[model samples]
Target: MIKIGTIELDGRAVLAPMAGVTDRAYREICAGFGASYVVSEMVSSKALQFNDKKTGFLMDLGEAERPAGIQLFGDDPAVMAQAAKKAMAYRPDAIDINMGCPVPKVAGNGSGSALMKTPSLCGEIVAAVKEAVPVPVTVKIRKGWDKTSVNAVEIAKICEAAGADAIAVHGRTRDQMYEPPADWEIIRQVKEAVTIPVMGNGDVYTVQDAVRLLNETGCDLVMIGRGALGNPWIFQQINAYLTDSCRILPSPGLYERMSVMVKHIQRLCAYKDERHGMREARKHVGWYLKGMRGAAEFRRRAGTLETMDDLALLVRDIVAANSVAEEAGR
Candidate 1:
């Protein structure tokens, strides 16, 4: 059990806050699968300050998923503080500042990873948000703007001094943009430099990788990002690997996997409306079918689906066709 401030989480596996993903339904699913903590997708402080209806929708959380952190991105100190206050109404377990997003639109505005270039401003932002919210505040950051300016250790010190409860370090530079390998040494350096708990992110694709990261970096937790896509079962896999050296179980068979996909679609459809839910489920459907037999043909057919009923039919048909082909090959 790890403690971030006064709150004690059940374990050290956390879900990274991806912008389009990590919504309420996704968070609950990850929690059910044994993730210790889940962060909300990055919400714009400007949008929250303006009371944007869409941003408010993003903050909705069911009662069961407690100890969830709400992440906010913005360059302005006052606006960020105000946004934290507004977000507190939703009863997030903590508030996280996004100093790590490398996207041009977000960084171009001096928010996200752009803050890495200004340590003083980043400290001020952290201080303001920490003062404004009664809950614990944390910051997520990349290694630095690039190789020459690799300053996560310095920035992490500033954040810690400014009263952040913990820090999450993604080892890639801003220019890397989720490419190649993550520098575990950098995460180790940050963990060594900080007094608070440090969470490591990037390239943790399998249970072995997660265990290796925790052992190598000596970080308090491992945050899984792209690794969790269409594979929420990873939490259980990692936990198993951590406890024993034995090989973990493989993912479910094709029919069972399709059942999970269908359930994900149905939950999204219920949480959001059918039209929006079906639209959003398309990318997930594609992810679920990736590398499967005849996935290209299945995806082409699935893409044409416009309603939940159509989606269910396409999935059932694909599962049935695959099962028959496997039996014939035997």
Candidate 2:
């Protein structure tokens, strides 16, 4: 019974909110795979304050993805509070502040990881948002701005004092971006320092990785980012392992993979219209097709996907290409 405020999550794996990924359709898919919780893509506080329709749509939390949070990224405490208030229209189970984003456009603007430079400001933003929203308030943070300024413990303490319900720590510094190894030790330190639940995020691509992360960091949960791009089943597998006598599940078969990918893309098209959804789905298709037989040629075709019909044909071709290889291999 891991409860983030009033929201009770049955599983331990949470879907980390990615910018372009983790839309409504994808979140539903991840939830169906047993993700304990999911967070919407980061919505700019400033954008929400400006009454941005597109940004509002990004915060939509469907029933299929319950126990989900709407993540907001910004530097100003007052504006963040107002944005969180506005986000409540979407009825999110929680409100998460994005303090870990390292991209220049966000961090460069005194937002995201750049907020870490002023630890007090981070606390201020959390306090304001916590006050403005009725749901639980959580924050996602990194080790530090760089190796020289490691201060995750300090930030976690301040945020806790300012009323953060939980803390999610990404072990890499802003300078590290997504490269290099994540410093799990930093996550352990934060977990040790904070009384609230801590979610360890970074480099968890498999069930074993999730287990090792929880054991090594002593964190309450594991947040999957890139790991869940095309493989949401990791959540179900983790839940099974933890709750069912250490049982391990096999990877999805090729038929299941293609089937799920098609359903995911079809739902995406239905949600955002084919022209837009298919464009965004290109990367998703590439991820789903990864490591398959003739993946290179198939991915090249995936890149040019336009409509649901095109996706159907591509999936057929992919299945045909691999079905023969499987037959020959056996």
Q: What is the C-alpha lDDT of each candidate?
A: 0.89, 0.94
Query: Can you write out model 2's per-residue Cα lDDT over 236-313, one digit (the tens) per residue?
Result: 999999999999999999999998998899889989999999999999999998888899998899899888889889
Candidate whose lDDT is highest? 2
TM-score of 2: 0.99
Judged by TM-score, which candidate is best?
Answer: 2
TM-score to true structure, per model: 0.96, 0.99
lDDT (Cα) of model 2 = 0.94
Judge candidate 2 at residue 138 and give its lDDT. Answer: 97
Clashes of each: 0, 0
Q: Which digits, one per residue and each the tens of the lDDT, describe model 1 over residues 1-330?
A: 889987788777889999988888777777777788889999999999789999998888776566799999999999999999999999999999999999999998999999999999999999999999999999999999988999999999999999999999999999998987999999999999999999999999888899899999999999999988888888877876665565696876887778777877888888898898888888778878877888998888777767988887888788888888899999
The positional error of residue 294 in candidate 1, measured at the CA in angstroms, is: 1.3
Candidate 1 clash pair list: none
Task: Write down the lDDT that model 1 would get.
Answer: 0.89
